[model samples]
Each structure stands twice: as structure tokens, then as C-alpha cells.
Target: MKIKKAFPPKIHNPETVNFNEPPAKLLERLYSSHMPRSYKKVVNGKEFFSKLDPNIAYQKCPKLKELLDKMLNLAKKSQSTAT
Candidate 1:
């Protein structure tokens, strides 16, 4: 005759198995609302016209320095307006 050994059943918390909530919900709970807004502005605004390199400006359009200067002035105006 052969003898068999029984193993214990696995136990898990019910909360760990469920993912009914959206991933954003977790982030929202963990961080303030301004966090997401600031993150987005930082990411998107990095591509804003002001950050472009002066060297590449010439290849992008004619009279690049003048164009870049105009863009910078406009950006400054907008920023001042916002505040």
C-alpha cells in the first residue's frame, strides 16, 4: 500500500484578486489632481515652440532667427497673460 500526503490550500485576499477599478482611479487616490495636470503641461509644453534649438531653426523655415524671435516673444506674451 502507498501513503499520500495532503498539501495545504492556497489563501489570497479578495481585494488582491479584483481589478474592478480603473488604473487611473488608483493614481488619482495616490496623487493630487494638480499632479496630473502639471505632468501633462510639462510633457506637452516641452514641445512648445519656445524649446526649439536655434541651430535647427534655420532648416525648418526661412529667416529662422527672426521666426524664432517672434515665437519667443509670443510665448512670453502668452505666459504673462496667463498670470
Candidate 2:
């Protein structure tokens, strides 16, 4: 007769699973709400198109940066654990 080894059951982490919102919607909202948009402006009798500056948004939105950092850290942790 052969003996079998049993493994422990998997644990569920609520932080890892989000059922309320999809990832695409979260990302879309993140960018749309926090990101700056380019627009046309008239300055000194000259018309110029302003370039979109990401720093402007970053400077204004600390929570956005925090969320992005947390997301990046989570992604890195998941990748490392997956392998």
C-alpha cells in the first residue's frame, strides 16, 4: 500500500479579489479623472496649443499617486509569487 500526502487548502484574501468594480473601469476612471488634458490657449496675441502635463495632475492629486504606487507594488508582488 502507498501513502499519500495531503496539502493544505488555499486561503482567500479579500484584498486580492475585487467584485464591486472591473479593472478596466478602475483604470479608465483613474486616468480620466487624474490625468491632464491638452487645450488651445491664447497668450500674448498668439494662439498656442498647450501640451498635456502629467506632473500637473500628479502635483494636484496625491491620492492618485498613492493608488498607483500601491497597484504597482501589488503587481510586482503577484508576479514574484506566481513564479
Candidate 3:
């Protein structure tokens, strides 16, 4: 996973991120990540409060809710069919 570096290099420490807060634009721009750089303490040895909580993201960005719901539904369908 690539550490997303902004023009000034944003998160040097994951603990600095404000979780369950900030706006949609901020979420996408700063914290819209599947990479575990923030979450995996094995890599950084710091506790990072979640900014990518799906509920928070959905509340901030309705579009993300819709997209995630669709993806979840598709995954469920695929899993059921596989079974």
C-alpha cells in the first residue's frame, strides 16, 4: 500500500487524524483509504482512531453510502451463488 503524500505530506502520525469527524471532502481527500498504514500497529506502533468508519463516511458523504451498499449487495450475491 502506498502512503498517500499530499503536497506537504499530511499524516506523519496516524494518531493525529480526527476520527468520526471532518467533512466528506476531507474524508475522501485525506482518509479514503483501504491501506492499513493507519490501522496496522505492527507497521507504526501507534493507535489510530478510525476516520474511515463507514457510518461516519455515509453520514458525511451520501454517495459513499450508496456505492458501498451496492458493493456489499454484489458481494453477497456473489457469495450466495458460489455457495
Candidate 4:
């Protein structure tokens, strides 16, 4: 007589199944973008455009720079008040 070997069960997670897929840009309105349409960019703590290029969006996006500057200034102001 031979004994059967036991094995652990595999977990089922729908999200992990698609882990190889590209990251989504569901919230384009707030994201910064750099393109030929950079002039149309809006970052007055308001909105942005979708389908932005990665290099430009993360690096040389003029609108993004403005938004980040505004955010940094706000942060500094809040920190000073807290102190």
C-alpha cells in the first residue's frame, strides 16, 4: 500500500490575477500632464487631462510644477501655524 501526498490549496484573488496589467489613470482631472496642449493645462487646485505621457507627467509637466508649488506652500503655511 502507498500513502498519498498532501498539497496546500491555492488562494483566489481577482486583483492579483491582473497584476501584470498597466497602471490605470482613472483620476485624470487632478493629474499633471506635459504635451503640445500644455497651454491648456489647468492646475488651480482644480483639474487635469487624461492619457498623459509618463516621462512628461512625472518630470517636465509645467502644470504639475505649479500644482506642486501650491501644495508645498500650503504645507509650509500649515506647519508654521502648528508650531
- Scored by TM-score, the top model is 3
Worst 10 residues of 4 by lDDT: 1-10
Where is the poorest 10-residue window by lDDT in model 2? Answer: 1-10
Write down the TM-score for model 2.
0.33
Give lDDT: candidate 4, residue 38: 26
Give the lowest summed-lDDT range of ten residues in model 3: 42-51
Comparing 1 with 4 on lDDT, the higher-scoring candidate is 1
Tell me how many clashing residue pairs each candidate has: 0, 0, 0, 1
Per-residue lDDT of candidate 1, residues 1-83 (tens digit) = 01001111432332242375543344344333334443233444454445646575455445656777899999999999999
Kindly list the per-residue Cα lDDT of model 4 for residues 20-72, writing each as its tens digit: 44223212221224222322225521332444354555355566667877998
Question: How do the residues 1-83 of candidate 2 rate in per-residue lDDT, one tens digit apiece?
Answer: 01001111432432343556543344344444544642212341132124436565455566766787799899999999999
Predictions in order: lDDT = 0.47, 0.46, 0.51, 0.41
Candidate 1, residue 22: lDDT: 43
Rank ordering of all candidates by TM-score, starting from the highest: 3, 2, 4, 1
Against the true structure, what is each candidate's TM-score?
Answer: 0.28, 0.33, 0.38, 0.32
In terms of lDDT, the best-performing candidate is: 3
Q: Assess the local accuracy of residue 68 in candidate 2 as a C-alpha lDDT between 0 and 100.
A: 76
Give the C-alpha lDDT of model 4. 0.41
Q: lDDT ranking from best to worst?
A: 3, 1, 2, 4
lDDT of 2: 0.46
